[model samples]
Target: MTTRHLVDPELVALLDLIPATAPSAENLGQIRAMSPRPPVNLAQSSTLSVSERFIPGPAGAPDVRVLFYRPISAQGPLPALLWIHGGGYIMGSADAEDSLVTSMVSAIGCAAVSVDYRLAPETPYPGPVEDCYAALKWLSTHGDELGIDSKRIAVGGSSAGGGLAAALALLARDRGEVSLLFQLLMAPMIDDRTSTLAEPHPYTGEFIWTRQANRFGWTSLLGQEPGGPDVSPYAAAARAENLEGLPATFINVGSIDLFVDEDVEYARRLMRAGVPVELHVYPGAYHGFRMVASAQVTETSARDQLAALKRAFDRSV
Candidate 1:
């Protein structure tokens, strides 16, 4: 049952670098403490200007913090990306993705907003997603001020962040507040039920992110057992009954990633619902394979993502 033999040879070394420890209430504090933070020299980027702001949060909630990245020399009215960071929805901050957002803004000459939404096990369900919505609303409403084009905005993220991005897309469509150009989901963790499946994928969930970790993360976010009948689509995008009218989508996942089946199924459903979709499944890969920055697969995935974002922006224009 070991999937170690199935992993891309180039990514095998990364297994030792990234521990497979599952998060539990007892060790969650230590995990959060060990999470990477934005570099002190984040503002040193010559091509991009990085700044932080406290924006209005969900009604009755504390203010949401966000990091904004903009190409210093870009022309007016650029496309923007509202990025959510991963960490199983329990850990991770906007600051952790400063470099990733900066690279995108620099490459695409677009504005980027990395949202610092409230984490779960404390905020729970609607709170975390609502914070993202508030950030999206703020970005869309203040587009002119941010030198971004509201019409060309996109939402994206990795892992739990991708799950939120998917949920946010559904929320935006149903609420009729914002029009998203596209959604970039990189190995999105969208199905709480994946952790509860009667027969799990033996090849997937054996690496960086396992079913045990997934269940812990989902339980933390829901404040209850995951895969329950009452799960909300807004909480778990895969629970959504309708994928109609969602924005064009770009989804990419490792063939052996824990969420591969769910991600692929979501893409198929989107296509069936008439949403334009582009999906990629890289072989011999597992969840978070992008952490192996030097690997060819990582490079390919990053290139594909950048190209898709650029294309989405171009079409918007």
Candidate 2:
């Protein structure tokens, strides 16, 4: 059964433009090579300044590279966001999301540090997430220099980046080193079990990021078959038993996305654990639908995200 008819009329054309290609060792290099890397143009925005720097990574690991975005004319200690990029844990670079971070920094009047974490199949689980932690610690410790409010930091990302954000939030809570104000998870890929479900969602996982791609991504990141018994919660956040004491969360996913069920369940669990959560499910949409920038759903999603961030930043917590 095809879900093509259910797709938003404006987003239908995007399906043809982005063919579903599962990543594997054989074609990973080619796919990555073809992935778009939009240049970070500071000239386009007079109010935002962007700089790249290398911060110390996890113990014994290499230095993690990060991109910092700040409002040029803003004063005082501003709230901060640690932005992560999405590419199913296998690919994607912080530089690729320059426009995204820049937009948020410009609109929210906040500082943002985009972490270029090491990717998987090569670095894997703790490596990628630990790199994010390094960035967060750097951001928190250098508040005086970065002009950021250490107590008001938030973590966010799209897809795999969102997964890392969730994991990082949990890690921050457990480690007691840095605190988070909010977590913005946009269709986060947080469950390895999704790929191994005996009976998968019939209408979802049919476009953009499909079940096959999910399986490949999970396998690469885990360095083992997904759905196995010993997957760590840090690697796949849904594996975590407890969701308490974490910061407030905002999660949004397309109804037809491969991750809708997992994301919704995570939100429900977060609420049950006494954490504040905001969840939105967009209808007639598939994974990565936001790539269709002109689509109404994409516009709505962006607005919702920005509004949620504003509220989080404005709150006293």
Candidate 3:
């Protein structure tokens, strides 16, 4: 018998609001060019700090940007999350994820430092990873002003952002530099090995993040052809040889996504290393299926992710 996800009814409205295939470079550039740069706006339920900045990137690149989100009307140190926005390391900007970041502040009631890492095919391998690591290091070093609880900090993101967060965890561990409390990896694209795309994905295969797009994202970021020898663990978190001593993690993926198998495998490795791992897989949902306007799957995915993040925050507190 097939199983059904406990989907939320409101997801339809949210998904319906997204434009199909609108996250591309041309579309994103057009939107940014036409619209005025909005402040870090919050929902009615949230109390958010404003005056966000796009400081010089940690990677020392000119255009590498980072946005800091602090909870307003709150006091003292709060558990923080290093939030990364997903656009296949190609097109997304910090503003593309303000709503989600705002919602994260509301749900977790914690300060979130959202890093706008450099994209691929330009910055390439180690670029985004290094930039994000720099942001994490900066946050930890300035925990007092940022109101962050250094011991309770976590890392999280969606899609490629999720992959980066996972990679960040490993990088922090390998470098023995910083500590991470938890990892929230929602539908991450971690594997560069294209051996698992046996069936055509129900979404984003021919739409937004096609197999070709995945190839480009992986190859461009790695700075060498993907599926080759000497792939960096920082470039593809899935390539990490050991997951021991890593922080606890939560991963959610769609069964119809090309990344499902690799995500599941990554979780397995995390568990194998005695790191606590919680995984959720929704059938019939494809890559970025949650972005499909008005889909039941999207709402369920969002609510589940919210619950997972809130739970993670609750655990640390």
Candidate 4:
């Protein structure tokens, strides 16, 4: 267990700027409305292009909004990434991830598509995951028109988005609908059991995302309760009994983040199940530490992610 004093000095400085109040599940709408939307300027902004559109969603559901980012200098169909945004399953939008998505477009040299899936407490369970799956299916089938290499599509996200990416990988494998090239999970929220752990891990869950907040996020997403026997693996990825057929995976988390234990365990299980996996745990960091651009750890994390994505894209080429 770590203490606030043990966290990275840069991260510690950054955390001191924000008020340390936990969000209320019942006031998600208000909180989401108040969330900040920062503008992003890609390093190679002139060479990258972005497009937006609405695609068919799961039957009876609203159309899903997708933002596509591509390199204007590309000579041919590019490998693609279906990016999901993290919001604890109750808040966030494609707009919220615009900066990171564009950065990936420039760094990974892959066409990126951000999915605007519905949030929970309102949409719940299959609703959010299905929306993301629908967007993935649309992208795969429309690869020709989108100038993408259908077979090289990968799924990725941060926090809750990371959880969705993992779940989407499982769904695609089970349904045989879309073939994925990779899965990138950053501080992913995977185990619903996390909130119910008999003895919670100390030194973690104290900054950024907390245990009480986690319970609210999971409960909001699961509709009923989290960690239930009948919970689907597609919703709570850590609940999966078999992790054999998933794609090559890249998992990263801060040693002091609430998700560190779950993410580490999942990576171990994936390796045991004979799946290709890469795991990175940064010490003295907290959840979403990569968001601190000035911190050296943030640059390292970004470079590591780009390296993994480059390897995946190269294999596809």
Off by over 4 Å in 3: 1-46, 54-56, 195-207, 292-294
Cα lDDT tens digits, model 3, 6-116, are: 223433343444444434334545644654546455433346774455555554566446677777777888888888878777657677778788777877678888887
Alpha carbon deviation, residue 159, candidate 2 (Å):
0.2
Taking the tens digit of each residue's C-alpha lDDT, what string does model 1 give over 274-317?
99999999999998898788899999999999999999999988
Tens-place lDDT per residue, model 2, 259-317, is 99999999999999999999999998899998898899999999999999999999954
- The parts of candidate 2 lying over 4 Å away from their true place are 36-39, 42-45
Model 4 misplaced regions, further than 4 Å: 38-45
Query: Pairing residues by index, what is the TM-score of model 2?
Result: 0.98
Model 4, global lDDT: 0.90
Instruction: Return the TM-score for each candidate structure.
Output: 0.98, 0.98, 0.83, 0.96
Residues 270-306 of candidate 4 have per-residue lDDT tens digits of: 9999999999999889998977898888889999999
**TM-score-better candidate, 1 vs 4:** 1
Predicted structure 1, TM vs. truth: 0.98
| RMSD for each of the candidates | 1.1, 1.2, 4.6, 2.0
- The lDDT-based order of candidates, best leading, equals 2, 1, 4, 3
